[model samples]
Target: MRATTTPALFTRPRNVAASVAAAALALTLVPGSASAQQADTEPVDVRLKVADAAPVEVATTPQAWPGELLEAYGVSVDGNDLVDVVRDGDEVSGERKRLRQGDVVRLTDVVKERKTKRERVRRGTVEVFTTELKPGVRKVVREGRPGTRVVVARKTFHNGEPVKYRVIKRKLVKDPRPRRVLVGREAYAVAGANGLNWGALANCESGGNPDAVNPAGYYGLYQFDLGTWRSVGGSGLPTSASAGEQTYRAKLLYKQRGRSPWPTCGRLL
Candidate 1:
């Protein structure tokens, strides 16, 4: 009588499912739970400083720069491509910056151009007075004689390569105008060869014309052949000069060649 048999009742699978459904329904019925979940799922926006630097000051106007910068950065904004990264000294500040989404970087370099000097000579006829004996040695005559004269003149030439780009294919095509630079003076300075004698030698070689290019492709006031020019350390010399500069280099070369570097003008040196 004290140990009565207890009946074990089996719960139907449908009844278990109903309990779980009731629990889910109770959770949905909780106040502000759905709103709390939404708040937890929302994304947050954050501000990040670049290079750990303070904010930079930016200019209201745009500036101009070389196209090479565009090639290095390969950058674009909105729908327009950048030709250069020009910052106005007065308008831009170290604190200046812009909003960007993709990979961005800054690069800088100094560009140099090859300079060539050329001279053109002209032939003309002129009247000359001379004493000449016509077989009998009895007559002085004035005659028009043909003569070839070399008037060394200078013209500067420059050529530039297009900026290399991999991302975009847009560029500004321009007709390059040769800029005339008086390099004869400065070229002689860097020539660092013979002071005034170098100038004299150059005058003899290239007529003190910075743009004087010989038929053999020799260039500069110092009638330097491509090989010889490079041999005598012409690699570092400026491509132009004035009379004073030409003389300066000429003297330096004279010292290097030691009174006989230039057989033709060594004495002058």
Candidate 2:
């Protein structure tokens, strides 16, 4: 026999009342099914915990429930992008959300970055300055070797597509080998005279006439024969050269073989 008693479950929540007893709990627990249908629970209040941590201050204190800066802008927190938990790279529908410190922002839109690497650079030429050769004359006495260097380049991409490449940094890995060059310069003069009177010798030889020639066919102020003049780096006849050149040759000749070449005139000097 079914009991004819009315069970009161109006004071409790629907879920709590459901577990009370299968014999009495329903949309309403009135005496008749007709009375239960007319009397129904409407606009009931329920509480649920959402995922993601909120401010510890809000949970511990009697403060207003989860609120954000967006509340001043009149926005609701129900699945709103602003109030939801956001990571560094977490995005929704191709739109970016707020990022936390630990979030890694993955930029899939346009990736433009510079990656530097060490590579074998082509050999380079080194310039070695030399005083052994003349100013404008260049001569490489030693061969040069190529050197290595470091080059940095940047790669640009757009929408996961490659666009361009450019060099960003350049550094020398190995220094270039230098070439040795020989150059020419003016010869240094001998410091002091060796007690020989060049003026006296010239005066005695041809009366100081650098262009003088003897009747015997000997040439110059110092009376140089072909054989002797050629030995002292004098081309052609000594008389054909300038006074300074003739004197210089005579001085050189004197240094080598002494006054013996002059003979009679040598005694006068």
lDDT of 1 by residue, 202-261 (tens): 667667678776666656765545554444444544355454544454455555666564
Worst 10 residues of 2 by lDDT: 55-64
Off by over 4 Å in 2: 1-195
- The lDDT for every candidate, in the order shown, is 0.34, 0.50
The TM-scores, one per candidate, come to 0.23, 0.30
Candidate with maximal TM-score: 2
lDDT by residue (56-137, candidate 2, tens digit) is 1101111112231112111123321223332433443222333222322121223467788766644444454344666547
lDDT of 1 at 127: 29
Which parts of model 1 have CA positions greater than 4 angstroms off?
A: 1-199, 236-252, 259-261
